[model samples]
Target: MTEIRFLHIADLHLDSPFKGISSIPQSKWKEIRESTFHAFTNIIEYAVENKPDFVLIVGDIYDGENRSLRAQALFQKGMEALQAKGIPVFICYGNHDHLSGKWVRFLLPDNVQVFGEKVETKTLNIKGEKVHISGFSYKERHVLEGMHSHYPVANGQHIHIGMLHGSVEGNMEHDVYAPFRKNDLIAKGYNYWALGHIHKRQTLHNDPPIVYPGNTQSRHRNEQGLKGFYDVTLTENNATLQFVPSSAFIYDEVEVSCEGIVHANELINLMEQSLNSYREANGNAIVELTLTDISEETSELIQASSKEEWLSLIQESLEMDHTFIIVKELHVNLPNMERKESNMLLEMMEEWETAEWKHVLKDLYRHPKGSRYLPAIDEQFMDETMQEAKEILSKVVTRGE
Candidate 1:
């Protein structure tokens, strides 16, 4: 039995800027862009040191639109290094890297073989071992049907491996692109499946392992958790797969509760301690803090006049000496204290349940004019305003009394 080892990576999304991450400094944009290339270089270095049989890139080599020339050049350079070692590369186009025009073609290394628009299989004989590889490209934007049906089943005794970029049937919002099902692949009897398009690494089967190697670098906050590639070892008996984390920066969310806190300074201290503990655990990870269940006292403490001062303190403490550490997002959920008291406010709240009151309240909140004017009115002002309005002629509306 021939021992076959290979590296699998997907969804590099190269040349894509980190959008909506305003907390990241403008100077670090270049470093962030280069980090994707650095991760790819590390993969090549691993290949050189460990000597994998070949490398498989499932899909999304570049961002979908507005790809940069620099990204292409850097990708080629990394591939060149791998080619120099005589390790072959196989690539398939995911939705992001779908070809748009004829002028986009560049001369790739002779060792790289890119699969085309059709679902076809290529067989390569490596050291007396037969390896059957199959894949297809996305010619257009949306693929609502199954592209895997076109893949031919494994024939003879060769070790069959298939690579495609698609979501299996109804995987959350991923049902649009090359939708397929697990039973379909299992019935086809492929030795292994190298899948992509999903950014989270997951394995579907064990006997003849079906895997989603996931994205090489995370692109946004939505693509959270550990980001990396896979190393697969193929044997006659069974195939073994391992995930390797290669991301230069990790993205995570941290939640802090201020249920009983009375002072902003105390809250800040608690938050700083929480952040310190998180950094100690994660070691150089970017975080977004959500301050939830903030008490009435804390809310009153952080009024409009002192908001900047508290924010400044938070910024200073979070800065520290770590260059990589950053607070990507901060949100506060103020407690609803009015709900606890039973008085005229509670009666008004109960009145909010009536259809007439509900309709009037919804219109008041939804309409721009009503929102702008309603908060400034007293009881007499509201009565006069409602009398003049056409929509609230019959509704009994009351304001602060």
Candidate 2:
């Protein structure tokens, strides 16, 4: 058996205009805007230095189907940089960057290869050993079909790998892209399965190693923590995986205790300490601080002002050096959300059943150009989002303290 080493990254989502950050000043835009590119660049630098056998970018490279020219150019530049180092790159399109939409295509380095809409296998001979990688890209925005069955079973001769940008059947957090089961991939008898779409990295199987490297960068608070890629070494019998942190700016959601604080100045001091400590441990971070068990006076003062105003005050008070800690949002003594809804929330949900999705998305479907590529609304996706919508709305309507 031949040993193979490669870097696996997914959901680069380059050129993502991070939402919920409009309040940030124009000067801060440079870091927030360039973070995605910076994240990917770090990964490329690693591949160049380490000299992996190849690189695997599973899917959803671009944020959307209509990718920006800058994003395309930057991506090609990274690919070319790898080509210079004699490294190869493999790519597939996820639902977010499906092939259906019209966009400008750049001339990529010959070392870069992209999987087509049909399920196909590409073989590589490294160190006189055969390596086969099987995958497919999304032609349409929604791929409800289970393409896993189309994947060729491993021949058991050398090394076989699978790349899929999809969610598991029961995963309701992210959109259902190319859906599959854990058992389905195991049945393929591949040495490794490189997955994408879900922003949080996970290990589905241990032995042969089925994994999701998560997104290289984060675009929202929901995709929190240290984001990065995976450096994998595979053999016929087993695979070893190493996670490499690559996010230039990490999305860190911190809940700080306001146990003994009375004055607003005290709160600021505590937050400053916390931020500095976090920055020391991790690199630069975009933090959303949640204050708990605050004094009555502080609560009144917090209630008097909006979160935005509080956040602005917090931002202005901080004096951070190069290892910066940006307070993106502030919340005051909010109760923890419960999975089981209260009577009042359950009553409100009764009316939601009568709601129609067609009425909600009528305008988008009616558009002359949009209707061309738009498929029917995914029912599973709708049901999932509905639950999230209920949860989000419940927090507002049922909140007391």
Candidate 3:
């Protein structure tokens, strides 16, 4: 009846260029760039302080297909910190960080045990308790075959945990890498399942605690909300899991009402207040503001030649107490104003519906590189966008009364 404690994290994405976010000052980008490292550092510190039996990084320790030496060094540093504290680490590489010939040169700490390219099991004794863990790493970029069939049954009597870095069978949002059905996992008879590949944290099953700890850091706006790891305590009777927040900056989108706002400074004030509220709830955050019900003055401000500069100024001004409220992009969704579709817009819509454009769009959606972050736009959504365009055009035709 002994309890086992460990830290579960995935997708640190070290040295992530954050390709999705663009058009900001280099100084700001530099600060934001360090966020992933900061998050990884936090996880290491927590492991050392808490002295967990082991740390499990399910997959995607690095961001890009080609691993960088700097990212490798930083990862080793974290491993060293845990090793110094007598904590063991288990790692499995996902599609993004699959093993390559280059890894033959990079060395990891002795305390770390990385799974190979085939499904295998490792047995360890922690605090006089025997535990059996099983998993595998992707040898190449794509692992379309079902590896779940290869997972052996749990060893008799020892605590069993299964690790997988792949998408669920029905998850069209992600590539079908190492895809497995939820029932397939349940059939394995493992005490717990640690999943990766998907950046969002989710619990697939509660009884045996099948979970995805999510990524340690958010790389883009698409990965919004609190990004961190899970602290799990397993007992003979029940398993308890707690989410520990370690991300340096939260990414979020906030909408502000400007029904009667007359001055740009007033808008800044409103945004600051909203940012403060977010900080209270989420610690520190990077925000994208969408202003609604914009007055004519605000509309004019939006159309002005210096709109980008003004937005940057607002972002710069929002900095206070070492917290940032960076407006990644500003959207002017004016209320009662027609989202007018001009002749050019109609022409573009027609082009979008054409077979050529559709084919291109599908290719982008199905691209292995993009499937991780960019969700495919569904047919219903495209239809809605077209209808909205027509409504906007009608409004434009009747405006200025």
Candidate 4:
């Protein structure tokens, strides 16, 4: 019953441009740009302190196809730290950081084991217990075939781990690269499956623990909440996993209800209080403020000719803690006035929900070039889109009347 511990991290996305946060001052911009490196350093420091048997980075060490020299240098530095500690690091290059003939490669530490562009297996012996790690790196931008089928079955004598960097079957958010099914992975009889390429953390299956550690740092609002790695401990009979937060900054959305706020001062006060709540929380976070259930006066302030003036006022009065709750953008959703069933806007939404709407868009869907970019106009999305359109229409109709 030998126990082995390892850190599982994926989608480091080192040297990301931080395009969304580019509007900040140069001083702040420099900090944000280096945030990814800071996070990777944290992972290394954590490994140094914990002395894990190995560190597993599933993929996408660099953000783009043409790897940046700085990113490679920073990654080598982390590997050097682990190498000094006599710990091993394993990596499988993902879609974004896939191998290319044109890449100017840098030498990694001796202790680092990077899977090649073909499916391969590496064995490790820790404390007299044998462990088998199997995976491959992407040779090109997209490895669409099911690579899981090529994975070797786990020999019962050793703990087996599978490292894969691709989308699970049917996940449309990401391109289908190295696509695999949960059942296929389970059938491989591996003790654990380490997954990557998806930025949102998820555990597809728990029996043998198919885990996606997500990305080390989130660059966009779509990627919200805590971003970090997983500390995994495996024994002959049991496996345990604990999440470790490594991100220096986070992106979050905070919604403030303007239901009762009468004066602008009162609204500002409520927003300030909300911002204050993030002060003692984990790390620095940029928040997108969304004001819902807003009163008619606030609606006018947001939509009238004085809209820019009101926005400037809100931004100016926003008392940031300088450490937390840094305001980024504001979205105002005006309260819907009580309307009768026969309201024109409501009737319009009902019409949008009808089959006739699909018929109207049929030509657009059939267009050779336009259809590729458009998502299949499914009923659920149609319902949501129509409702959103109705909200905008209601606002305009109310104002016009």
Q: Pick the candidate with the highest TM-score.
A: 3
Better of 1 and 4 by TM-score: 4
| lDDT of candidate 4 over 231-346, digit per residue (tens) | 99987678899999988888988888887776767777887777666645545777787878876776654565454455455555543335434667776764343343227656
- What TM-score would candidate 4 get against the native? 0.81
lDDT of 1 at 18: 73
lDDT of 2 by residue, 1-401 (tens): 88889999999999998988876655677888999999989998899899999999998899999989999999999999999999988999999899997899788889989999999999999999988999999998899988898999987887888999888987878888778999999999988999988999899889778899889887888888889999998876668899999998888888888787777778778888888888888888888888887666666656677778878877876634444578887767644323233545555544454245666678888998879897666666566766787777677646734
Highest lDDT scorer: 2
Candidate 3 per-residue C-alpha lDDT over 208-265 given as tens digits, one digit per residue, 9 for 90 to 100: 8889988888778888999999999999889999999889887889888877777767
lDDT of each: 0.74, 0.84, 0.81, 0.82
Model 2, total clashes: 0
How do the candidates rank by lDDT, highest first? 2, 4, 3, 1
lDDT of 3 at 175: 81
Candidate 2 CA-lDDT value: 0.84
The C-alpha stretches of model 3 lying farther than 4 A from their native spots are 101-104, 295-306, 319-322, 339-401
Candidate 4 — worst ten consecutive residues by lDDT sum?
333-342
Residue 279: error of model 4 in Å?
3.9
In Å, residue 79's CA in model 1 sits off its true spot by 0.4
Which sections of candidate 1 miss by over 4 Å? Answer: 23-28, 102-104, 257-266, 292-313, 336-401
| Cα TM-score per model | 0.79, 0.81, 0.82, 0.81
Candidate 1, 169-220: lDDT as tens digits: 8778554599888988887788889988888888988877888877876656
C-alpha RMSD in Å of predicted model 4 compared with the true structure: 8.5
